[model samples]
Structures are given as C-alpha cells and as structure tokens.
Target: MSTPQGGSSGGKVRGWCPDAWRPMMAGDGLLVRVKPRLGRLTPAQAVGLGEAAVAHGSGSLDVTRRANLQIRGVTEAAWPDLLDRLLALGLVDADGGREGRRNILVSPDWKPGDDTHRIAAALHDRLGELPALPGKVGFVIDAGAEPALSAESGDFRIERGSEGVLLLRAEGRAVGVPLGHGAEVEALIDLAHWFAKSGGAAAGRMGRHAAPLPDWARGSVQPAQPKAAPAPGQRELGTAYGLPFGRLKAPTLIQLAQTPGITGIRTTPWRILLTEGGMPGQLDGLSLDPNEPLLRVDACPGMPECPQSSVETRMLARRLAPHVVGRLHVSGCAKGCAHSGVADVVLTGRRGAYDLSLGQRAGAPPLRAGLDIDSLIAHFGAV
Candidate 1:
C-alpha cells in the first residue's frame, strides 16, 4: 500500500470540510464534495463524477460517513468548470444555505415507495419547511418498520416502534417520541425549531447541545447503533465494496462501479459502496475480503492536506496496519472527525509528533507524548 501524501497546498479550507458551492482547500488541491441525493448515485452520475474528478481535480474520491462522496485534489482554476459540469449533471446545489442544510441520510437498502423511501423523500422535499438549522445538523429517515440506519450517523431520526408506532428519535437519547405516521414530518420540523430555540447556535450539531428533549417527547433510553454493513462479496441485494481508507481513485470507481446491466450504487456510513446488481470482483486498492486488517483502522488527511492537522496520518497508519488488532484511529489533530467516539487504540498527532492514547478518543490526553512515528509503531505494532 502506498502512503498518502498531502504535498504542498494553496487553498485555505480545513481538511475534510465539504460544501457544494464553497469547496475546501487541501495540500493537494481543492476538496469538493458531491452530495448524492439520499446517497443514491445513478450509473450515469457516477460516470460523470469520475470524469469530472479526472478533468478538474485529482482522481481520488472519498465516501464520507454521511454517505456522501468528496472529490479530492481539484485546483482553484478548475472549480468553476467543475461546478458547471456538476450543474449539467444535476448534482450542484446553488443555494449554500439549502445545500448546507441538506444533510438528510437514508438507508441505502430502502426501495422505492417503501416507508423508508417515502418518509425520506418527503423529508428531503420539506427541508425548506424546517427552521433555520445548524448546517451540520441533519435528520435520519430510518423508518422501515425496522431501523436499517440506527447505527448510521445522524442527529435526528424517524423510525417505527416495536408496536408499529412512528417515533422521532434524537441522537443522544435512547428512546424516541411517538408520532402518527402522517405527523412525523411536522413533528420533525417542530423538533428543529425546538433545537434552535434551545441555543443550538454556532455549534449546529444537536448532540453538542445540552438541552433535553421536551418532557413529553422523551421516550426510550436505548442508544441506536447503526446496523453493521453487509459483509464484502455477493449478497442477495448486491455486492458491497470496502477501501483501505475511506477513499479510492476516480478511475477505480468509474470502472468497477458501473457494471453491465446495473441500476445504481449505494454508499454506507462504513465508507463502503454497494452495487445493486453487481458482484465483488478484483479491485487493486479495495479490500474484497471482509476481514482485511486495514479495515480495522480509521484516519484523516493530515499535515499538508488539512490546515488543522498536526502530522502525516495515512502513511503511519499503513505502516501500523499489521501490528494492531481490534480498532485503531489515527487522527491528524485533536478533532476526531474520522471516528467520532472512542477506539480501542488512538494515535493523535500533535506538534509534528504523536500523542498516544491507549483507549480513548483522539482528543483525550495521550498516555505518552512526544513520540515519533517509528516509536509509536513499535509499541502498538504487536497489539
């Protein structure tokens, strides 16, 4: 595996920061995200995105935890042309506010006209109806009688209860408030207003706020863990794909993703892709084997790529791949965007060196400090 280098960059956007109109700058080039509506990309859209990545940027692509795709290494000069191409492909959202607020996530397995799809589609259309929300705050339309995206990322969710009751679930809370099937959207909109009114200001994500749900709205206390993704290889629905990291080359996606007689592709919070009718075949960078060691790691574009990053992350992770077991997170900085929660072992970069945390988030103070990459690897390589 080749190490990812940030190189020298010219732009000023933070690493992994994505918006439709305002692309973030990285060490390599501009990083622009392509937010597929409901995380579903048509075969044509996928091909066009692959072409756009090649033409306007580096051919590298990332599947985000939110199930959106980011195009990496786009130059400043190519942004306008890239936007034009995205517009032509019906992928660009001109309104920055609308684009920012359009963070709805759906179960990739949702079928047309099903409850998940129906509620999700309705929620998408009604985004404008909700109060002005934090750009990062989003709703998870996981209503399919049973929750398919419970473990998936989202702040608010719509789900059906055990008794076939519809409920509005909050991210931090275990239980959800019940609502009638027809009233879920209105209830969701009301919840948004409540969140904003409760001082969900600059820190727009709901989980960050301390305000509790309405007394009547409080339901269960059980955490909603998103369901595990399909094991790689052929499944009844289709084939699921995984990458060494969350990213892959455009050529790889364009070629391997669009197979003969396939309909569309689905992305997961695991950073894997699902081909509806396609099966797993040979792919150089991706892991067709579900148990691949690299799959147990998480990392971000550090140093040159992210202005906030403190060191190089991907290369160190690649080297540490064989020595570690369970789960490991290599965060460029204190911000643990790669893995929001704790991991079995975390390597956080600071001041060009790394702070090692035995079992905690990257932000937690390291058990040891001022260690170089070599030292860090030697210690944990055997875990």
Candidate 2:
C-alpha cells in the first residue's frame, strides 16, 4: 500500500516514460517500467518477475498500453537490487539507452519465423544503429497474416500491405513505401535518420511533425485489414485473461506462471495476457469475461500512487462502472495516461475535484466542474 505525500507529485508533465533504468517518480515512490523482448516471457521468467515485484517494490504491476510491464511502489534504495534481479532474469535490456530507444511494439500473436516475428527480431538487433527521437515516438511491427496492432499507438509502421507486400509507413501519412524482402530494417533506420535530421525532434512525435515524407518513401498500397482485438477466452495460441485497469498482484502472477503446461506468456496492449499452452481456468484478481464492465472503463492510478493527481480514481471508477452506459474514463489528471482517445464520458481530476465531460477526452471542455465524489457518483447514476 502507498502512503500519501500530499500536494502535487511534482514533475514535468509527460515528456519521458519510465523504463528500467530511468524510472519516473510517482506518489508511490518510483515506477519501474520493463519492456519484454519481443513482448514475450518464458514461464520461468514470469515467475521470476513476480518474485522480483514482491521482493523489490510494490507487490503489484501494471500492464501498459505499449505492451510493457511496470513494477510499482519501488523505493530508491531498492531499485539497484531490483535492476540486478531483472538482469539475472533476462527480462530487461542490459543497456538502458538502447532499451529506451527501442520503442518497438510487435504483434503479440506473431508466429515464429513469420514476418512479424522476423522483422521484430531484426529491429531489436539493430536498435543501436537508429538515431535518437522523442521518447513517445515508437514503431509497430504488424506484418503478420492480418494486422492486429493497427489500432495501437505508433509513429512508424511496418505492416503487410495489400497482396502481402511489406510496406513502411510514417504515422500521419495515409500510405507507405514498399520494401524488398529483408530490406525492412534498412528502410526503418533510414527513416529514423531522416526524422532526426529534418527537425522532427521539435514536434516530439512523427505524427505531429509537419514536414512531408521523402518522395522515395511514398507508395499506393493500403495495409491489410486489421483483425479483431483479442478477448478473454481460449485462442488458437493459448488462453487469454483480462486485467481490470491493467493491474494484478504478485501472487496472482506467480500462480499464473506456475500453472501446469504453461510454457510462455505474451502481453498485449489491450490489458490482456496470453498464457501459452495453458487451459482456461478461474484465477482470482483477473477477469475472463469479454463483456466485463470494468474492462470497458479506463482508470489511472490516482491520489496516493500518482504524483500529478489530486483525486483518488480507481475506487470511484469501480463504483461508477456499472452505472455508466458507455465507455468511461476516470483520468487522474488532464494528461489522461490511461486512455488518450475519446470516451463516452471522461471524468478528469482537477484541483482535487472532478470535472465531467461527455463524448470527449479528459482535456475537453467539461459538462460540469468541481463536483465532489458523492455528487459525481450521483450524476453518473442518474445518467
């Protein structure tokens, strides 16, 4: 459990994200984010991570939208030991800078030796060759049979174009440049160098940059159709389970890792975890229902956990989840880290009070402002 420090969490608003070496200070000590290589974990690695979480920081973890994991509530003193443990488990990149710059998201459903898998592996190996860009800027490898990560956030994309051709695309652009077989990484590195040299760093993200893509990087092929988002249930690859607000306790993780016949674990951006080779079964502190109301809602760790927040979030979100009719977002602050996209109803925390918005995101003009928790609950209950 986290003890409150009172006042603001006191940090710049949203410049860099937390990584294993450079962790962000939250209300709950520090938040250490870990990026799994290829978004995968052996069953032993999963158990090791669970134990590390219990031994080093808060006995809880957060599954990020980037398909990464965060160990919460770590004190400054414990971070060194925790990092050593992570290195031993082979869960984090040895070089922090390389890990930070390798902001690549691969399709979790990728098969071995498939386009997604091979490209992802190649990119990981060549990350050191790429120039530095903004921390939030990232790449996606969705060159699978069907694009599953198309809707996820990314500034650069490698996807299967129409008729199964491989294409590299900038995020804001509608089309991409076709690549010859095995030339994917070379094109990606060249694009990164271009972005770095062309004043794209000022914009902080490729999609936000105004400069036009190079002429050679243009193509007419549309990407393959995106597959449906994975849901909690059995899949051809494994059994999937959803985490409410992308959070789970250490013991639960240990239990999942120790399940018989489970050989690996795959993390997805949708708050779902795939237990490779495991059968469907009940697990406490996890949801198996696709239609679970809490799954539809997004809430950040507020109050005592996040330094930027003034109000407690998840508890109120839980109480209001069933009462709301559509997608609900209870953001700790205007940044809306939990969900950047629009929601049916967005409740943003401001000056320790709640501001309500309908059919908008957290920063949009609110329908009502400064409502206390009880009144906020009543307002949603009446809706």
Best by TM-score: 2
Model 1, CA-based lDDT = 0.77
Residue-pair clash count for candidate 2: 1
lDDT of 2 by residue, 268-372 (tens): 999999988988889987888988989988999989788789899999999999888899999989999999899998999999999999999997889999988
Give the lDDT of residue 253 in candidate 1. 79
Query: Which whole-number lDDT from 0 to 100 does residue 135 have in model 1?
Result: 56
Report, for every candidate in turn, its global Cα lDDT versus the true structure.
Answer: 0.77, 0.87
Tens digit per residue, CA lDDT, model 1, 1-383: 11122223343334234665767667677678778887788889889989999998888888888888888888767777888898788776766566767788887778888878888777777877778775567888877655677766678888767667777887777678777667877888888888888887655577777887787668863434445567677766677888767988888878875677568888877867888786567876777788877888899988787777879999888888778877889999888878887888898988889888877998798799978977876786543
Kindly report which residue pairs in candidate 2 clash with one another. 9-307
Q: Which ten residues in a row have the lowest lDDT in candidate 1?
A: 1-10
